[model samples]
Target: MSPDIVTDPSRAKRLKAATHAAHDRLDKSIMRLEPFSSIDRYALFLAVQHGFHQDVDALYDDPALDGLLPDLKHRRRLDKIAQDLADLGRTAPAAGSKPVLAGDLPTALGWLYVAEGSNLGAAFLLKEAGKLGLSEDCGARHLAGSPEGRGLHWRIFTTALDAVPLTQEEEARVIAGARAAFMRVQFLADAVFIPSPSD
Candidate 1:
């Protein structure tokens, strides 16, 4: 094992490192969607977000995770997404398939990492949403930055994730789960009407 994994193996750090390719897939996928071009596409973006969150919403209730990050439930954004859709005078759009997650704890944390880590990206997305005439109080509530901010919240989650012990094989599962989570989001991005701005 590398000294880093042996001495201070942070799941968060490792997840970020190991899942770079999957993470890039999600990034490239989102960029193909020019959500800022119009309000409709932006709303569709919100629906995509809702769909992804809804599928994995139950993870927060997992007893094993609760023992570690009891406040895991607090990170749910389905209700917020619903509220944003309501603000737009729309309802939840149908999503694609449910995400296939790992049933084990260490593996599940990998999924959670992808889910919770998304808020950090939302800090930037929220700004882009603003350019489309949306705001936290209205159609972009789900994209709004948290009062506590993404950095602090992510730190809390990563700290909890690293605190858990895992075998190297288990760590492999966790990394795979994170990659799967990203792949699921990329799949969701496919069903939408991805648009581009007129240059």
Candidate 2:
């Protein structure tokens, strides 16, 4: 079944609930790939991140979604990512180009769900970075938890997401957006680096 079908069992318009379920269902295999296990792997991860956000951050300018999630601009990490790549002697690759957003707010929020939720995963990834001697002050800014704190910031987004009243159809688009966001990350990951059979 398509991963987005996780949303099929969901009837509520609560974007948080639906999106969270989508992440849980779809990201397990991607997460298992352990993109931060080494500096090369980590750098590739950073490049793809830079590419994805550089592609999607324009969604922040969408007045419809911006009105709902104004702090969207404040959440950008492309600059941090570019610096991290530079520290690693890498450049923002051509792969860092724009991603497709389907041109609407709910779709943007679906993408936002993927982006913000990634921040919540930082506490774990930060430790992996530590294993490679990377830190918030040095080569791993993206894995550094949100400046405000991870859990609290995630709660703020989820609260806003759940509070928005979506139509049944809008909720579906949101789910589709979240799924697309995951696929983009996975696609870029494959573009930049993929573990060999022995790994």
Candidate 3:
């Protein structure tokens, strides 16, 4: 069964703070890491916003670096990553065991985890793990999610089931964190839609 997210208040507060801090830090760091071109910035934003979608693709598209990740090589890597994620999503439960949720992963704040196509599963997985206090192979690595390339950084928790088999405590934290991150991404999307006076 899914953990109830509403009753507890503390988890709600902590997740809000953590996600906001993450969003803010990502924004500032991206600006420092890339040129001011619109495409560069947007590419970076997508890495953060649609993290589960095209991080590897964006990295593969980089050109100025010269042989760093040539076009053909980049495409191949992205294709492989996508295929792996898809395989993970379609994997069946072990014999005599049933799925914990209807889908491979639960939808959080209307954002379904997109495996085999993006790094979103990694993001959600990281967040969920934090709530459960589990350890991960990557040990909270950032999973890139940036325009320049895929990168890893230490995150809070690990383990895919950390988000799953959640306790009442963990559930509330996941919901709050998911909601806040969702709102932040939505705001970023809306900002992209706004027309400037120069336009």
Candidate 4:
């Protein structure tokens, strides 16, 4: 996890602990791809973001979820990612088989947790994008910081996430969903950023 992220003693902390290993693996995999190596490489990275966000796009607007996380609607970044892709002169790849979380709000929250938590690390990513001549208004819109800023934005999100009541079974499913979300990104990263033979 980014040192900037503070996971309090709540469901968010539990998730941070449970998903730590998977999260580390995903980060290492992405770093190995070196998505910041160049503008082209970053475009491939955006494609991966586009694909993963596209999979979870519906969750942002889900009425049930919005009731729990009131700021949910403004958090959707798929369109921003699409804009980034367009700025780079690339189109979104065809969707893959998305994770099946429909009608399963607990599981869906887990997936949403992984997606939203990523923004915490976007501060570093946004700087790297700058090296490639991409800014919030240009090719890196998806990585732009929220007006509330990263730390406060994340705190607000995790606060709401921790407040949602869950049965024991649902809590277990939430952990599983978060892990699955990480694995899904790993799969997409592999597909979108094919490694050279030497890698």
Which of the numbered candidates is closest to the native, going by highest lDDT? 4
Candidate 2 overall lDDT versus native: 0.73
In candidate 1 the C-alpha lDDT for residue 124 amounts to: 83
Error of 2 at 84 (Å): 0.9
TM-score of 3: 0.26
Cα lDDT tens digits, model 2, 134-165, are 88988887777766789888877776777666
- Model 3: ten consecutive residues of lowest lDDT: 152-161
Which has the higher TM-score value, candidate number 1 or candidate number 4?
Answer: 4
Scored against the true structure, residue 199 in model 1 reaches a CA lDDT of: 20
Q: Ranking by lDDT, best first?
A: 4, 1, 2, 3
Where does model 3 exceed 4 Å of error? 1-6, 9-12, 34-166, 172-199
Candidate lDDT scores, in order, read 0.79, 0.73, 0.34, 0.88
TM-score (C-alpha, index-matched) for candidate 4:
0.91
Better of 2 and 4 by TM-score: 4
In model 1, which regions exceed 4 Å deviation?
A: 1-7, 99-102, 194-199
Clashing pairs in 1: none
Best by TM-score: 4
Report the lDDT tens digits of candidate 3 across residue range 44-69.
33333333333223322333221221
